[model samples]
Target: MAIKPITGMLRRQAVLDISVALGLGTASGYAWWYGYHVPAVRHRDQFYQKIEEERAKAMGQQSS
Candidate 1:
C-alpha cells in the first residue's frame, strides 16, 4: 500500500478548521453558563441588580 502526502495548504487549512471549532465550542459553553446556570443561582432582585450593574459598566466603558 502507498501512502499519500498532504500538501502544505491542506495542512494549514486543517489547523484553521480545528482552531475555529475550538473557539466556537468555548463561546457556546460561555453562552450556556450565563444564559442558564447563572440565573438559576440568583433571586429575582439580585439577578436584576447584577444585570443592571453589568449594563451600566458596559455603557460607562463605551462612553469613555
Candidate 2:
C-alpha cells in the first residue's frame, strides 16, 4: 500500500482544528474549576456563622 502525503492545506486545517479544540477545552476547564469546584468548597466562616446563629436562636427560645 502507498502512503499518501499530507498537503499544505490539509496540514494547516489540521493545525487550526487542534488549536481550536485546545482553546475550547481550556476555557471549559477553567469555567468548571472556577464556577463549579470553587463554589462547592465550604467556607469556614459562613458555616460557623450559621451554627452560631442557630445556637443563639435555640438558647433564646429555651430562655424564654
Candidate 3:
C-alpha cells in the first residue's frame, strides 16, 4: 500500500543521485585532463628550461 509507494520513491531518488554523481565526476576528470593538466605540464617544462638557461648565463658570466 503506502509502503510500496515510499519504497519506489526512495529507489528513484537513489538512482538519480548516483547518476548525477557519476556525471559530475566524469566532467571534472575531463576538465582536469584536457583543460589543466596538458597546458600546465607544457608551461612547467618551458618555465624550467628558461630557468636553466638563465642559470647557465649567470654561471658563464661568473666564469668569464
Candidate 4:
C-alpha cells in the first residue's frame, strides 16, 4: 500500500496550524527572555525615573 498525499483544504489547514504554532512559540520565547533573562540595569536610572514620574503624573490626574 502507498501513502496518500494531503491536498486542498486539509493541506492548507495543516500549513496554517504549523505557521501559527511557530509564530506563537517565537513570541512567547521572546517574552520569556525579555521578562527573565535581561537584567534591570540594562536600562538607565533616568529612564526608570522618567517612567515613575509619568506614572505619578497619571495617578495625580486620575485623582483630580
Stretches off by above 4 angstroms in model 3 are 1-4, 48-64
TM-score of each: 0.52, 0.56, 0.59, 0.48
Cα lDDT tens digits, model 3, 28-61, are 9999999999999999999999999999999999
lDDT of 3: 0.95
**Candidate 4 ranges with C-alpha deviation above 4 Å:** 1-7, 40-64
* Candidate number achieving the greatest lDDT relative to the actual structure: 3
Per-residue error for 27 in candidate 2, Å, reads: 0.3
Residue by residue across 1-64, what tens digits does model 2's lDDT show? 9999767988899999999999999999999998887776656667888999999999999999
The 10-residue segment of model 2 with minimum total lDDT is 37-46
Between candidates 1 and 2, name the one with more favorable TM-score.
2
lDDT agreement with native, every candidate: 0.91, 0.90, 0.95, 0.86
Superposed by TM-score, candidate 2 places the C-alpha of residue 24 at a distance from the truth, in angstroms, of 0.2
* TM-score of predicted structure 3: 0.59
lDDT of 1: 0.91
Kindly give the stretch of ten consecutive residues in candidate 4 with the minimal lDDT sum. 36-45
Q: Count the backbone clashes (under 3 Å) in each candidate.
A: 0, 0, 0, 0
| Residue pairs with clashing backbones, model 1 | none
List candidate 2 segments past 4 Å from native: 1-6, 43-64
Candidate whose TM-score is highest: 3
If the candidates were sorted by their TM-score against the true structure, best first, what order would they fall in? Answer: 3, 2, 1, 4
